[model samples]
Target: MELGACPKSMRYGPCGGVRTGGGCEVVDEPCPFVGRPLVEWAGTELAPRAIELPRFLVDHRPTGDDRVDRQVLDDYAASGVAVLLGDHLDDPPAVDRVAAAERTVDAGVPTIATITGRDRSTDERAEMIDGLLAAGVAAVLCVTGDHPSARFTAHPDVTFVSEGTLLAGEVRSRGGRVAVAESPAAEPTRQRAARLVEKQRAGADIAVLNHSGPVADVIAFAEQASALGCRLPMYAPVPVMTDLASMAALEQFPGLTIADDAVNAMHTSSDPFSTGLDLAVAMAGELLGSGSIAGVNLSGVATSGGAVERGRVMRRVVDAVTA
Candidate 1:
């Protein structure tokens, strides 16, 4: 391959996205900086991995924010959160998710509401879409809601809902940007690849990987999807590793991955918060650089401060990488 162009910031600065495995995050190639006698390679060797900053989103937990809406919105907005995501957390009458998204839009930030394809009747599902449209929600992620058994076994938030593909088709016909979730891919299989293609054929604009796992999983899924003829824009989910308890919770959630190394690092590090932050930066940089991925969604239960700080740092990394 020809030498890719580099930015001034990276031309002479330390490369933070250099993986612990010693691979260049900007390119899938070996770290050119490693064992190189040429000093300029430190700055100019790896061309900027991205031509533009990918879409960065903050996944906000569901809140009865009549209590803290203003503070939450202001905090996220100030923290440089570019997009807001309100999950269809376990709550009665999944339609409530649309209202949750409405609250996000009311905050003046673009938001995405996750709608489940179960629980409600067909009319209810359509009404939910109408509610989001009327509320001016910028986007919606239609998901095949959790199974009924999950409510009792998992966090109280799991619930079955409508079909995600049908929801995406409806949202598209109504002119709302729509997304769907994919999962369980440290290793990709044909079944998973075919499902992704089916979802895209159903009108999903973006394929949001369902787990908070390693960047490799996302890349692997993308490659498999491409091989299967699924052209959906792929968006990887990044975890907000604050408390170990919350981080560990991801393991129980189906379709998400929290690698053992990550788990161990967060558990053993003197400052787990910074350690997790570095991991997020590295993963986001890798995903952004990998041309297969369209963007990333930062997901976790974090304070508005934590969420904002995550976005700020990731944005800086993007700025530097694409500088």
Candidate 2:
């Protein structure tokens, strides 16, 4: 009777798991929904979705172009993982793509390049697209890079020149898998729903929901995605601020809610490593159970070590839940 639980009609295999669909059969139970197949609201048949978990990448800037940063990227690629680069780096969007591509050349891990709207010129965008194709970066997360407002000049510097959805479409047309970032509470629920529909319509292959709020909010958001008739993948963010300075910096991000207790707990905890593992397990369980989510996107922090650790945690969680 509970959502995500096994249906009655499905037969169980010898594996001791419920076989709701054709994927595999569980051993010890009768199918709950005997005659009723799990179908999308529009009456479409459902399919098992595989998840892609990549390492989160950060851009490190040192005055001008730095070889050190490139070396750091080499280390990241060695893990056969992807990363997100900061937008502040020179050339912003395209530079990250180029850097990531360079690493992919040697490491063989796919790169999920970030695109910031401001630093990208028409020419740069063209070159970046060419570079991505050449490097074969798996997918691109299109976002309007974060911009500062009114620090000095009367006119503050601007951020993303175009909307993320439109930009994603452009990338997709050019033979790239495009993912766009959206916030559940960037506005009211209705507004978010409308925007999500529009993004799907515009050719976004995946939607990344930054850190989730209440469970109800996430369910509602997933329902909206289903209604939009677009089965694009959804990436959920799980924040990682295991220390005081990091926690403080995270709190400053707009729309982020890091509980004071949670922050302090992470700071003093001796077993933060285990804590992260536990959190990843819980999140992976929920994500896999949903049947709607295609993959898990680890957001918030960016580093080779951080991404590899989280990716390992995710892999463990997936094996547990799916098995």
Q: Write the per-residue lDDT of candidate 2 for residues 6-67, one digit (tens) a residue.
A: 32121210111222231112224333433343221222222322336452322222122345
Regions of candidate 2 where Cα sits further than 4 Å from its true position:
1-96, 150-156, 214-216, 258-273, 302-323
C-alpha TM-score for every candidate: 0.70, 0.63
Candidate 1 lDDT, 34-147, residue by residue in tens:
333322211111111111223777666544535554565666565455454544445434336667777777776677677765556778777878888788866677765544
Evaluate model 1: give its lDDT: 0.58
Output the TM-score of candidate 1. Answer: 0.70
Error of 1 at 107 (Å): 2.7
Question: Number of clashing residue pairs in every model?
Answer: 9, 14
Off by over 4 Å in 1: 1-54, 87-95, 154-161, 186-188, 303-323
lDDT, residue 315, candidate 2: 42
Alpha-carbon lDDT, every model: 0.58, 0.49
